[model samples]
Target: MMNRHQLPDTLLMGYAAGALPEAFNVVIATHVSLSDEARARLAAFEAVGGAVLDDDAAEMAEDSFDRMMARLDMLPQANARVTEAAEGIFPAPLADYVHRDGRSIRWRSIGAGVKQAILRTDGRASVRLLRIPAGQAVPDHGHRGTELTLVLQGAFFDGNKRYGRGDIEVANEETEHTPIAEAGEDCICLAATDAPLRFKSLIPRLAQPFFRI
Candidate 1:
């Protein structure tokens, strides 16, 4: 059970309808894998969608089958054992995007003991994994668009709230926060942003373009 933050029904519905950007979908998929509550909620949405489709006598386009077949070719194979928990922290879905686990990632440092590995995604949005050392704070910033952050390991505090593993924080232009990883362990999070962030300070702003943050 996710105690603090859970994926909103709106986002879960969007994910069910296959309307979200691929990067966001990745984050949602991984979160669903980790949280039983999220998985159940997502399943409800999918069931609703399925019932709706069944009740509607919709005509399929002549090319629909061909298009679906093409899409299936692009998706994961039905028999692949890629969604289960790995020996490392990464679950199957995330590992499919990255690799087997943390060791497979080639981390890039961005100063202040923070490191990140940008995941390959479509140009519509960008996603990455952030490793914040214990007790260190990410630079204060606002969002230009939607941002989805999921804690994978350890914990962090932002806006007087604590987010631990499986907790997802959703932020938009109206949200601004400085997230600090808690002590005792490093915090690892998978973050997806639709647009670049709004930095409050000069150094991070200056370095933003270089990091493609």
Candidate 2:
């Protein structure tokens, strides 16, 4: 079961409606793989989707609900096998995203606790793939522009908020906070930023130029 604050209803609805990015969808898929209650909720979301498809008055464009249903039907049924398969596929969910050929990631280590892969850059803003080990602290920093983070695996705590898989966090230049990874698992996140991160301390300041994230 998902904890009370685990995944927001908006994200769950997006996942069920097939409206999320592929990377974030993979995380929601993994969560549903782990929880029967969440899976049932997803099923409810699909039912709502069916209702949308049945709405004749809307006259929307092709929603591809049938295609999505076909894919859902193909998903494995055995519980053990489903869990194993989802776990196996977790690490490489971005395979298709990376293979599109136009985008690439440049991995660089910024601190003892973190390593980052610069996934794409438009000269101004950039996207990154980041991993911070269990119990490690991400530097207290703010952004020069906007920063949007999607949690792909594990959990992290910042201030009073605890973000888990499939959560999308939007932070801006005005948001300055430090986060610590939970004790049991590493925190892996996809971060998109429009400008350089502003380091808050001497350590990050010294490492900023050499850091890739």
Candidate 3:
């Protein structure tokens, strides 16, 4: 169970309404796959949307109901089976993107015992996977826009709080901190950002263009 933090209600509603960008959608879907609480919340938001539609007074064509039923019949079931990753490391939605077990990830070293793999996503946002060695610290940085980081394995502490598996850190322009991985195991996180990060150190700022962190 997730204990650190939950996705913001605005994001949950956007996900339920299918209004989020592909990058945000991917992160939310993967998080929901890992957290029963998130899944239940998403269901509640969808239920609210359905109720709103039911109360709408718009007139419909004579065959609209039949067409809707036919479309529903053609749609794939919501509970359709997804191929599970080994040991359940990657959630089903994420597994579909990586198409491999976590250990088999093609990691590119980003220096300081950290590795990353960028994921292709639509729109202006960027998505990536970060693997930080035990006790290693990410460079101090602030956000230009918003960043959503979901812990897939192990844990990390960002001075103010500790985030473990299934937990999400919602960082925005107002936040700045260095995240250090907890000892004992590597910390793996899925992150999405809408703009370039604001690095405090000169080294990180200079390397930002090349690393795209």
Candidate 4:
């Protein structure tokens, strides 16, 4: 089986509430494809979210409930059946639209010690996999829009907070964070970056044409 990690509660909560962006949803879907156990946990969280929504029924807008129910009823059952059939096969293809070249990930180096590959480009932001070697730092960068990252393997410290497997970190224009992979193994993460990263180096500026990060 492929190495899998459980998601942090915060991310699970955001996913359950449907607050996560669409691009990030593709990464979550890939992780779901890899780990049934994690999917089951997220399912439970969704159930709890449903229960809470029910409990707050009185506060919900009248049309909001009807709209939600309408949308639910409108969903095609065929898609659910197809997904179930696909899950039975499990983890072989990496993901529906991702490029895979064997067990070890194929990475395109973007900066010093930072390598990435687009798992799936959904016409919006590319759903990407990133690896940073221990003690390696990325270009001290910020985002033009929201960025969502889910740690898959190893760990990294960003702005004093340590993120491990399954921890989803959200960054936007308001925040600036520089991450260095923790010592031991390479830090591998799945992220959906909505906008181009703003780099702070001349090397990154020159290399930007060759490497799209």
Which candidate ranks first by lDDT, i.e. highest? 1
lDDT of 2 by residue, 1-213 (tens): 123334566667987897765445644554565557767888888999999888867544686776787899788776544222323324344433343475555556787669887653334456667889998989888877656676777888887788887665667766887878888988987776667788877887887777654
**Which residue window of length 10 is worst by lDDT in model 2?**
82-91
Q: For model 1, state the Cα shift of residue 49 in Å.
A: 1.1
Kindly give the stretch of ten consecutive residues in candidate 3 with the minimal lDDT sum: 79-88
Per-residue lDDT of candidate 4, residues 107-177 (tens digit): 78886868897664545665677889987877687788767777777888886778887566767787677
lDDT of 3: 0.85
The ten-residue window of minimal lDDT in model 4 covers: 84-93
Off by over 4 Å in 4: 1-22, 30-104
Q: Residue 30 in candidate 4 has what lDDT? A: 58
Query: TM-scores of the models, in the given order?
Result: 0.85, 0.55, 0.83, 0.62
- What's the alpha carbon RMSD for model 4? 8.1
Candidate 1: Cα lDDT at 133: 99
Error of 4 at 7 (Å): 9.1
Query: Which residues of candidate 1, in runs, are more than 4 Å off?
Result: 1-4, 58-82, 100-103
Best by TM-score: 1
Model 3: per-residue Cα lDDT over 5-95, one tens digit each: 7998888998899887777887898899878999999999999899988886977999999999889968876765555543566787787
lDDT of each residue in 75-167, candidate 1, tens digit only: 865776634575677777888888735357888987789999998877799999999999999999898888999999999999689999989
